[model samples]
Target: MKKSFLILVVLLISGMMSAQNGGNDMKKFESQLPQEGRGNVRVAYQGKAIDQMIYEFMEEQGIPGMTLAIVQAPYIPRIVGYGVTDIEKGNLAAAKTLWPIGPISQGFTAVAIMQLYEKGKLDLNDPIGKYLKEIPEPWKSISILQLMQHSSGIADYREQKAFDVSANYQPEQLVQMVATLPLAFDAGTDVKQSATNFLLLTSIIEKVAKMPYHDFVKKHQIDYLGLKQTYFGEDIPNVKQEDVTTTANVHQTFKKDKDYINPSETTTGYVEKEGKLVVAPTISPTSLKGFADIWASAENVSHWDIGLAGSVLIEKPENRDIIYKPTKLANGKTVPAMAGWQFYNHKGLMDIKGNVSGHSAFLSRFTDASELVCVTLLANKEGVDLTNLGRKIAAAFDSSKMGTGANDDLLYTYESLFSVDETMSKIEKVLKTMGIPVFAKFDHGKNAEEVGLKLRPNQVIVFGSPKVGTALMQENPSISIELPLKISVWEDKNGSVWASFPQMNLMAAEYDMESNPVIGKMQELLEKIVIKAASQY
Candidate 1:
């Protein structure tokens, strides 16, 4: 009995110590999270400080692994990874970790079509029937450009109730499933994304190049750019060299080096099951075909993007514009999106993003900024949209040109990770922490109840620094009407909480005080505070 008691006591002490260590580590991590000022976090870039936004995002979203690549003008300054690619094995994610970049493959397909057009082998205006004989008669009349831009009105096979996403389907099988179905609309009347459009494009690519779709993209895009870490679905690229410098897998300060880094294995896909993560069923490469088959490291994906920015890939500026420009319907109205990319209100900002079973991918390009900035994010979690996070990360590099603060939109709203009441409490706490006084709290829901009206969980917090507000009001006294800044937190009908604030830059334009320095500072502060309150640490 004495021996057993001693062993039990030791085990209990060890368990308590382990729990204490874990808690301490978590505290340290939270301390380094992104806020208004800097923290003690270093990343593996050219003396660049770690933003910590990505870390906080992964923690909040329960993401197992992710790879991020940032492109600044002509140089890719940073490519890094966080968390484990294989949760079961606890394998660390790295820059070279391969991920299935869903829908981003459409960009590749579009490039191939453009490359052929540049070669005079195909024309964007040519009807599909000119190259593809197997397509339906209606589809045959659709212009190649229409198909590329999702204006073909083709029935999407993936959307059919009978379709099994896990089944290994050939390109022809997918096309045939929707072949007998009627078009959703006239050939070029409207815009609707369909995987079948890209499938036919793949067939056309095969016919024109006399090679498989993957091989053509490999030869033209991958091989041309010397992207060794890029490959077709499930086909991880091989490493030839033996010796390579490797960054520490966990978050730690990394030394700069010129040596080639060893590539990590592709991340395992995951899906949530009963509030826990489980390995997702492997999706067949054949099923993804032309629309979503490509797998690549975040760094290589951005590298390929750099190639697209110049004449190296497309070779002609006008040809590149053909794909980048929005699609126009027969009614003469141009769609706001093209080739899986959507044009944001911000000038020259465009992005392509989607989920592939158990993986989520995002790529954003700030083309018209003074410096070109591209961000690619690949995470091993399904259904999580990274578009906002990508834009936020870009803003960290150049705040003046990216994110909500500089967005051309009249207002930018953020999705809160908590309920309306909780989100409002967080906002109030942040105000207290920042020493910014809260003037008043308006509980709209409560007010509605008192007035015998119904309202959702809606509330607003009015707060700001008087020093900054005074400085701004000095420039334009009329701005005071909009001053004493307010942030609204409310729950939409869908039960998702959101926080919204006006773009200070737009307000400056309204009041004709565009040159006021306080405007910029106020914009930056509001952005930081909202993000901190809206997101989970």
Candidate 2:
């Protein structure tokens, strides 16, 4: 389950490709487009078929049931559902079939906090102690923003392997589990993705709103925003039998298959387990609320997205910015991930994803200066790559800038006054500073000499952190080709030396890795090392 949550975090921060050629085309299309409704817009696209793409992806990923909503802002959302909700009963998943959203609950929690802020009930900078007086000493100093951004130094409850997922834990019990442990880092100094953050935020919401967290979210975000099919529970509220999708462990069935026929070859239907169709085990919502445990149809989730993008849920539009804006530390360094949602600044996208025992979800909102578009996907299986699949769907609606071509060149270059050899030495020193092992060093100029050909001074230093590189490769093994990071130092004809290395973000894009805290840390380290290597001082 912890691994599933980690996967969710990774999916949440993976930024989409920016629109390169679509601006003018999109503008022209928008001019001719008809308005759909209050929070909906019609978007035009010339990309490949979206429905077929989703069908193929679901088939390939063994996703039993999925519901998707594509919202072209200021227009009615296009919602679709596929496959059977129940394997044995043959019930079809539909627009109102509720699926557990897992950690996407945090996004709602963040919105609730911001709603309170809009009403002047709380300040984001206020310490948790302000609302929850029982917060421990060091934790008392941690601000609400810190908790929202996962920079409060609070230990993650999931990190405690012994903690019972099967056993229902109350909000206070969850807090107490982590409250006694020493912080992972100084508050506000670093960001670590932790459900503990949202758990505390839930408590804060209750204290500030003078009601249960669920009540606050229901009154302010769901009912107020007109999310008719959304609810905070393991089961779909007021939905009987055929209305809600049955969550299944497709991954488990896939693993157990002996013949292992490709899912695409078989018709979409029940997931058979040893000649018997299997249904997902029921779990209680009370066990996962605040951190996980929110259920909604894709359409309802899209409605929530529309509400957020339009700032209709929060009275103060500016307060809504808090959801996607990164938290800045006292030292002025900004955490790349936002307080409530993971933001890709370059692409102007906000993302939220969740993966629990039997469900996975992804929601992305693209907001450029001119338009806002949202794509939401909810699935009743664990292994589907919702982030990539959602991007594919978004591209179908706006193909102007959606392919996997490296959006930006990976290479980051810095000029230095020192000669090529000196820069190479500096590169090695910088790598050493971070304990990244130097795997190999190649002097291209020397190789040229051996080949009896003259060449300019050029050297490449290969170094990497196995812990970091291995983690990346574990996610996508193909990334091994880009692993064991390298920095090249060369002297130009003008005698100016330059050091260059691949930016981790570009590498991540190339390898299809998500932008999680580990990747963010790797990027920070690479930037620091490259700059230090090229610095004259």
User: Which one is best on lDDT?
Assistant: 1
lDDT of each: 0.78, 0.68
Q: Residue 462 error for model 2, in Å?
A: 8.9
Across 92-183, the per-residue lDDT of candidate 2 in tens digits comes to 56777777777787888888888788788999999898888877787888899888888887888867765665467777787777778999
**What clash pairs does model 2 have?**
40-74, 40-75, 41-73, 41-74, 41-75
TM-scores of the models, in the order given: 0.66, 0.64
lDDT of 1 at 226: 98
